[model samples]
Target: MKRILLFSLLLPLSVSSQSNDKMCETLSKINALVKENHFQPKPVDDSLSVFVFDKFIDGLDENRNIFTKSEYEKLSKHRLLIDNYIAKNDCSFMNDFVSIYKKALERKKSVLEKLETVSLDYNSQDSVKFSKDQFPFDLTENDFDRVWKKRLRFDILEDISKLSKNADSLQLHFTEIEKTIKQRVFDTNLCKVNSILNNKNGVKSILKNDFLNAFCYYFDPHSNYFSFDAKSSFLSGLSTSNLSLGIEVSMNERDEIVIEEIVPGGPAARNSKIEVGDVVTKVSNTKGEEYWVSCSSMETIGEMIFSDHNKQIELTLRKKNGTTIAVLLKKKVMKATANAVYSFIAEKDAKVGYIKIPNFYADFDERSPKGCADDVAKEIAKLKKDNISGLVIDLQNNGGGSMAEAIKLAGMFVNAGPISVLVDNNHNQNIINDFFRGEIYDGPIVILMNGYSASASEFFAAALQDYNRAVIVGSTSLGKASMQTIMPLEENNENDFVKLTIEKFYRISGESHQIKGIIPDVFAPVLFDSLIKRENSFKTALPYNAITTSTKYNPLPKNITSEIINLSKTRIDNDLRFKELKSINEEINFTYNKPRNPVRLTFTDVFKEVHDIDSLWEKVKNATEKENSLLIYNTSYDTKKLASDDFQREINTFKLKDIKSNPYLEEAINIINDYKKFKQ
Candidate 1:
């Protein structure tokens, strides 16, 4: 199935003037880059280095990233092999290279086979520990189909190495590699045609999962790729594909799929016939096509779900005690619970109430009139009943939703006016204006943010900060203050792309939020950074830059700006979390950012810093997770209304972490207190 590779397009990027340094300088810079990212180019053989050979291979396939800990550790240990391969200037290393190639392929197939049967025990508290625990899973597959997923990645690199010979042929091989990877999935899923497939909910979920697995493989590890359908479904907390009739699946110690949770209203929930800890053996559709999907088969089960949502699915399930039950189910629509919820916590001045904006979702048609804007308005009305003292807006981990939402939400804090601007790749501008004529939640206001507050989250918080409408608190926002909009393509099988920042956002005051996240006037440390380390951030992200000036509204009192800079650094130094973050940052070496063939002093510095940061980052992560659990339990009280009719009574209490550890909110409360007094 190898089709001719279409290489008429894809011109190589022009080497930048910055990259035009001498060979030695280039080599040194490249060395530092490699070390920072932990890359290696090993020799494939004596005739032709593996690195050179791998060039085509790398281009042909993207990583499936299903390596077990042992596999990854093996790669890490033998990384020099890759370097040797890359170092080979000529194709002298063929025989040995072939051996290495064969061995690597065998290893990848063996590992991938085992992963097919692997499923997580989400209920296990020990699950997250895998990040720290490293490889703990079992890999036990038979021979991989020729040119499987990981094999394709390696093959592409090989193709690249033999460029003169493979330029035309490699592209053909690349196409075949993709086709086989996809076909293997379809083949493997056939193993799942047990009567258990009768569950309509399970079927849809299975199908939706197919899309997720395929979609996710396209982006950088942290970034995600979603199909247009999946994207729409996710934005509104709806995944029609996977609503349970009441069965949740897990794998037993023997690697068998286990059923865990059943929803109350689900068909499985009402039947009392099925019990927890049940294991699934076979699945089928109403038409009775028995699932051929076995642990070793290469078909995709989810694709089956995609076949027909309207059809009933049948599942052949085995109870732990050894009884098998044939259950048939119809799928139903299920709503996704909001990641973050809002409530009116306290009526401070018979007018001020608190609101928390969780992660943002713009909703269908990409229209999110309610994500933050409408939610804020509703929360304000409820909080207004108390003659509220002042309001607090919490934006912790609200990585942002629609830009429209940010502007509309921010307008709720101020009296009126334009809040932000959106510019496209060509730098054309679309200005978003907000004029709030409604009851201003006019009391003393505080906007709460944390390091995870990014994108639209930062935009809204910055507006409040700049306007002096609210005193901002908590850690500095995540520096991802950029924008992107999806663009439809003419022939889209899946090539439709999103255009990201060609232009920038300027505050009403004409200040840019690029690279530099909004700085809070009042500061509180996120406890996670106190324990975890975070150096080398600049390496992983886009360069921070600014755009030329444009007209915008200015809000803050001029003196507040200077006071903020002086005070922020002082607060940061004193904060336990920031102190720890700085300690980690300072230890990073310059060599990670510079060239290192001669091993400059900078490289030495960077290596030292990396070690320090690595150690600290672990400690911080463990500390934050553990600490938040304790803090949440200790501090939050289920707030009840003084009057039964009060909306506050209906509101839920912040879990323990939300209640006790927010020194930032405490600081904001203090700021509000001062603002109230100062105005008098």
Candidate 2:
């Protein structure tokens, strides 16, 4: 029935006036393209042709450029519905596709206009309303975790009406839940008044925060509504994405930046008497005096931290025992130290150099010195330094970044030529450059990708694969081949705005990164397959990877197929940890088996478990008391020692080590050691 409907729709597309055979031939060609290229097609005679065409338009906008010119010409010819667009009475698929698409656009004209208003006053900071109410958000420093929850709740977006059934119901339900939240806050607020506490500051603090967050709720996740104070702060926070002194800090009773996470081999990683929990009470310039920089009363502190570029800051610290100390450190722009790991792995393979490109962000301006280009060049220098081996670019989890970066990065591997092709519904094509001037790492290359690799990562990997520079390994990458555009909510808050899918990218070979992300040449599952975080929003994320045919280059393998396979098998067999992990994961899968109805164990089962637990605890406690006579005494009740010989004699019988603390992490280390040969 569906096929008959399609055929009938095709009949109307060309009309019986001309040759019916000619119309059928056109339909057949279009079908072949759709089938061969993995292109998803809308139903014939459906309004979807226009939607696809408009979607193509959106993708080519400032933020989304992926298709090539040749692709556009082919698709444009395929767009004909009933009228002549390019040549009158041509009756080609492109003309018909365009006509149908234009009609669809006319119908959706209002919806497009409605989208324009999405940037206006969305979740503006001006709308933040504060009250004495703190219902679900009453917290001391000890309740720091609770603060995060409240802040996240207030961050919910509204204002833009969802497209009916296309909205998240859970999000809408939370909108309604705000009423009850306020009532509870009101109850708590009243109780506070009875205590005669000076909570005006606290109330004002919360109100201000709500106003700012609610404003950002109007835009995409990355868009943020910031206060004048926060504008200075966002700039500094962005520095973290680039490069900075490898330091992670937190505030204390006396507020400061306390270093926490340190990347190994980084300048600040360990070259210090400083410890993790030391507080950065104050930071000063080269002058020895402490500067009165304030992180107080502000939601963000990075503003002050990065305000002074290429300068030294004297950091005064309050130690854990309340001792004061100071440390002066110079700032250095840090590079992601991921390359060394790969280089080490490829050291043994005299024929393989490794490059793990997480994302492509090239700060290609006089403003910044280090970027994807600089980093890649440095790594290439290293690979070349070794004087041996092919190259393997590990792009496992890289989502994507700038097109310029992707293009430039792709150029590093391949010699000059066309990289990828972009095709729009109008059959327009654009050629992406593949410039390679010198120092091409022309060796047997392999690109390691997985379901998580996407976007610019896909572009880099696909370009390499298209150019025959690398063989893709692992499963199909995440198909997010589409592009997006960012439009700000207000000129005042440049950071806050709408990020929408704008365009689709096609490989030079004409493959969309959409649903079918880059398929791996070799399907080897990663070692930590059981640990992938799947309960995420990614399942609903828009198409960023789509597929099309090659625009220019065609790559073939160097016949290392059996070698890679042999290596994989040897590692799997020898690595006991991999085997154990595989076994354990299989058990976990069974534990989470989906069922039509959830299991409801009877009351008897609950009784059995509780009785067993109680018995087990009692037995353990008894054994502990006997083994450690003094240490296993009382948890809540403290025993008073008598000023007598008997008490002293009793205390002497205890051993401290007999009673153990929770040893899960240690147990894990031991387990790994058992399989250290190939698994750890």
Best by lDDT: 1
Report the lDDT tens digits of candidate 2 across residue range 129-229: 33332222122333322322233223222111111222345335644543453343333323323222233433323322332332222122222223344
Q: Model 2, residue 412: what's the lDDT? A: 75
lDDT of each: 0.46, 0.44
Query: Candidate 1: lDDT of 631?
Result: 16
1-680: candidate 1 lDDT, tens digit per residue = 12323332222212221222222232233333322322112122332223322322332112323333344344333323433533432212222322333444445555456544543121222211112223332333332332243333332232232222323454456455434543444344332232224434333233323322222222111222233443233223323446444444444434455665554345565465666567766667766566533542212344343244435667667653333567787765444433244654432232335677765556557554446577667666766654557777888757677777777777777666667665554555566666655435777777788776787888887777766676677767776655544332223436323222333566656566655677777555464433222211533334455554454565657354345445544755686655654454444333133332311122122233223334444554444433311111110222333244322222222233344444454445545555555556
**Candidate 1 segments exceeding 4 Å error:** 1-104, 107-238, 241-341, 346-352, 366-369, 436-439, 491-503, 530-543, 547-657
Instruction: Give the poorly placed runs of model 2, Cα more than 4 Å off.
Output: 1-262, 265-346, 349-352, 364-370, 423-428, 435-439, 450-452, 474-476, 489-496, 524-540, 543-550, 557-577, 587-680
Query: How displaced is residue 226 in candidate 1, in Å?
Result: 6.9
Query: What's the TM-score of each model vs. the native?
Result: 0.48, 0.43
